[model samples]
Target: MAVIKAEAYGHGMLRVAESLAPRVDALAVSCLDEAAALREAGHHQPILALQGFKDERDLRAASQLDVAVTVHEDSQLRLLAATRLHRPVRVWLKLDTGMGRLGFAPSRAAELVAALTSDPNVTAVPGLMTHLACADAPERPENAAQLARFEAATRHLPGERSLANSAAILALPDAHADWVRPGIMLYGGSPLADQSAAGLGLRPVMTLSTRLIAIHALAPGEAVGYGATWRSERPTRVGVAAIGYADGYPRHAPNGTPVLVRGQRVPLIGRVSMDMITLDLTDLETVQVGDVVTLWGEGLPVDEVAAAARTISYDLLCRVHDRVQVVTG
Candidate 1:
């Protein structure tokens, strides 16, 4: 399963899904709405709803569309049992294992399995599933404990089991059960903290690129942008790129954040504003306005930008605004 939720982690749902549909066995989204959108866009492949239905209406839609939902709560099962639909729905029984966020208690798995199997409204043998909370940190004992719990709970269960997220798929080979769900890994983002995308044999699927719109030659002691947070230490040629927080660039990305200007790396020297960022192009003498600048793709890693912004690649990728144009190569 390729996790395409959060607009395929902000890479664009329809775009990614259209390209990946034939290649992937299934595409998973955050909710029924995303799946619906994909279906409306003519993507007829299997789509798994990670959080499942919010109500019977959603349940009804899932039944009609044959969208698979993750049933993690007792209420969800009850909702499924109560919902009247023309066809049985496909479902994944989420085991809590060690992740406190979702899934039934391990002790409650047998009960859920029994109830779900007995219910005629849902598939008798649903896929068994679990989410890894610390798969990115391979050294964490949580991964082992959770895997053990999942294995112990589902040993007797009769269904396909899927427990590997991108991290588990890359790092914990043992955790790759019947199906592996690759999310960040599909977009060339590193699931391991100690690894780079290229190091892991992953390439960025989406490259965010923009152009510089203006330039400024600042004298020593001259400050730039909101709050005058940073001043020129010496003679500086500050160039403003036509991208900013409103463009889904981090507003809090501190000075010295790396941005590629004309394939030359330069330090971001001011607060990222609503529609622009100041770059100290002092090192490059031949650059000018209208030059292309890569915010976090191509030459620079989104993770590096996120680290400087005190955030993560996931946040940066998903937070991209809807107005930005996306073209998949």
Candidate 2:
């Protein structure tokens, strides 16, 4: 399954779903609305709601929409038992394994699987899935421990099993079961902390580019932007790009963050404001107003920008504001 949740990590969900539908066996989303949106958009492939239904109405809607959902908690199980649907709703029984977030205890896998398998409202033999907490850091012992727990619990079960996210899909070949949930990797972001997307052979699907709207020559003693956090150490030509936190650029991104200007690398200066980020274009003497500036993507990787901002690429991708125009090639 291709995990297109969070608007395909802000690359546009419906478009991503439509694009991946022909290649993937199934598409996974975080909620019923996403699944419904795909179905309403004429996507006929299987859709899985990773978070599952919130209430009986949601469950009923899932059933009616033919969207499968994860069954992780007792409340969801209870809801399933009490509700009568026109058709049986498919379910994936999530095991806690070691994530400690959602999922039932692994020890109860047999009992819960039995319950779901026998329940009239549920499809027979629910799929099994577990999230890995340390798959990104392949050296961590938790990855093996979670896999061991998941294997012990579902090895004898009858349904299809899914255990690999983007990290595990690349690092843990053994964990690649019947279904592999490729999330970040699908959007061309590296899931492994030590690896770059290029090293993983993943091409970025989104490029956030904007124009340099203004340029200012700052004297050595002058400070720029909000808070006056950064002052020119020397005579500096600051190029202001028409992109900032309002466009989903990281506000916390410190000075010296890398941005591409006229195919040359420039250091961002001053605090990232709501609608603009100032860049040190001192070295790029030819840079002028209206020159294209790449925030992240193409010449620059989102992972590198995320690292400078002390965040993950996933956070940056999903935080892109809807106000930013999306131009698909």
- Could you say which candidate leads in TM-score? 2
The window of 10 residues in a row where model 1 has the poorest summed lDDT is 77-86
User: For candidate 1, lDDT tens digit of each residue in 158-260?
Assistant: 8899999999999999999889999999988898988888899888777888998988799999999999999988999999888888889999899898999
Supply the global lDDT for candidate 2.
0.93
What TM-score do all the candidates reach, one by one? Answer: 0.98, 0.99
Candidate 1, residue 77: how far the Cα is off, in Å? 1.6
lDDT of 2 at 6: 90
What is the lDDT, from 0 to 100, of the residue 134 in candidate 2?
92
Which has the greatest lDDT? 2
Query: Which digits, one per residue and each the tens of the lDDT, describe model 2 over residues 142-255?
Result: 999998998898878899999999999998998899999999999889999899999999999999999999998999989999999999989989888998898899999998
Clash count per candidate? 0, 0
What do the candidate models score in CA lDDT, each in turn? 0.89, 0.93
